[model samples]
Target: MKNACYCVTEHRAPLQRIIQDTPELTGDQVLLRVTASGVCHSDLHFWEGRYDIGDGQDMSLSDRGVTLPLTMGHEIAGEVVALGPDASGIDIGAPYLVYPWLGCGDCAVCDRDEENLCPNQARSLGIFTPGGYAEYVVVPRAKYCLPLGDLDPARAAPLACSGVTTYSALGKFRDAIRTDPVVIMGAGGLGHMALRMVRALSGKGAVFVDLDPAKRQAVLDAGALAAIDGAAPDAADQIRAATGGGARLVLDLVGAESTITLGLAAGLKGVRVVVVGMFGGQIKLPTVYFPMRAMTLEGSYVGNLKELRALLDLVRSGALDIAPVTRRPLHDANAALMDLRDGKVVGRVVLTPDPA
Candidate 1:
């Protein structure tokens, strides 16, 4: 089979088109025909050398390295054509959302459902390996691929990263803040998704904070009862007032020091702050901040298999639908990324390998 992909030839050049040969399917792997790949902010970070993935074996390590001539696209979904040895429960020609994050399953973290933090983890179809930008991808571990039953392939792509990240963050604090209000910062892909996931997962608090009026409106559209600006001097105060003097949870998808600090201020007596954005910055709160408010600041990457499953189920049920995706053909990958960088998107952008 022939694979046609787009690559960033050099550091900041435009995405160039390339054609390559496909290796024969390995016994432990399956060949999947590329379908849809979401234009994620993380990819833009790599393209712009913002994430600073170095030239290394692990994509997370070389978050900014982003060496040249890479076929990139991680948030992916496609149909499986062939499989290799011990690929037991997988069906040929089934549509699946490639989990992409592959980790050594033997680690203690993986054994305890924390595969996202596995030491030997490597991402596929984008960063660490030849991704779904082409016609095919080699899924070494078929078990990691989740079949996309009735879900639209295009919309399901972002669920792998942006969607899964929000779901996992909200799931972590669901039990602690069952009926308390929560704060979500930034209303872009991750923020918007978190608004919906937080409300659906816990049916609890729904406070949103963002600088962009357009994004703040998106938060309201996604069912947030209150949406305000995190840039204002009184932002945190407003959040506290809306949630009755404080919020129980605060998710900072922006990850800037200001946003993280606002999250700290917005939290009440028993609050949890989850930092998940890579906005290229750090946050520091005084020792008294956490101790006095009894606040917890934790960071979360995407998520594990169980959390991804719960996200998939949420989308599958009518309870949650991140659909109405703005889609374009694979050839338009650069344009899509530019859109994301400019904050011109109201919803997630999914790049379809095959034009409809």
Candidate 2:
């Protein structure tokens, strides 16, 4: 059997099409016929070869152990086509959302179901291993496959990343999301997913901030309490006014220095700020304010397997509205990545297998 894939043969270069033998499965492994794969902003960093870490320096993915000729779509949903001898419990014809954040299964973190946080070695798919930008993908474990039920494959694909990332971040705010208007930064894919998850979780609603007028307007039309221009001189004041005071729960989906500064400026004392975006940059703030304001600032990575399952349950119950999705053929993977890089995508973009 043959597997057709689009791979990153070099940084900042177009993905090259490669055909190879389909991987053989073993030790509870499962083989999927790639049904849908969502293009993510993180893929841009991998393609560009580094992350903007503020000042004049950047963090290279190569330094962090990423190698080339990599397949780079982590938000994947696919149909079961074959399985190893030990693989069981999931049917061959069923569709599932693949959990891409993996780790050394013997570690303490993995034992606690926090594989995404494993400090030993990051084995995340689309990063450390082959991923779903192809006609066939090999999952190392059947446990990573979560049933999609009746959800659309393209829409369900992002639940593995954007959906679960926002859900887990919102989970950190706890009941604060219900008591106050949450301040959300960046109205891109993650921002829109955060907004929908807030409403689905029964939060008080969100006040969005973005530099793009179109994105700001898009979220406003989607039911944000207010959409303020993040570049506006009085942007903080606008957020404060929208929240009827300062925001108590602020979710920064864009981790740039300016966005973090805006979020801090717009937050009330004792506020909790969760930074989830990898846009990358650094910020400087007075140390005294940490105690004086009783403020909290932390970062959240993509969520774990348990959270993904919970998020899927929420979607299955019809409580969480799936983010808007744009579909393209698998052959357009390079175009999809470029569009996302240029800030042209309104929501998630999923790549489907090219028709035979």
Which candidate tops TM-score? 2
Give the per-residue lDDT of model 2 (tens digit) for 1-356.
79988999999999999998986788899999999998987888888889878787899999988998999889999999999999989889899999999988669998887889998888888888889899989998899999998899998998898888999999999888888988999997678788889899999999999999989998999899999999899999999999998988889998889988888898889988999987766789999989998999989999999999999999999998786689999999999999988878866789999977
- lDDT against the true structure, per candidate, is 0.76, 0.89
lDDT of 1 by residue, 1-356 (tens): 77888886664667788888877766578788878887776777566654522233224435423456777788889898888766767788889998776556678876776667877755445876777776788887777789899788988888888888888888778675567777888777676677667666666767888888987886787678799987788887899888888888888787877888788777778688898876655555678866887878898888887888878887888788775788888888878777877878767788887654
lDDT value, residue 58 of candidate 2: 91
lDDT of 1: 0.76
In model 2, state the lDDT of residue 41: 79
lDDT of 2: 0.89
Lowest lDDT 10-residue stretch of candidate 2: 340-349
Q: What is the lDDT of residue 150 in candidate 1?
A: 79
Per-prediction TM-score: 0.90, 0.96
Error of 1 at 282 (Å): 2.5
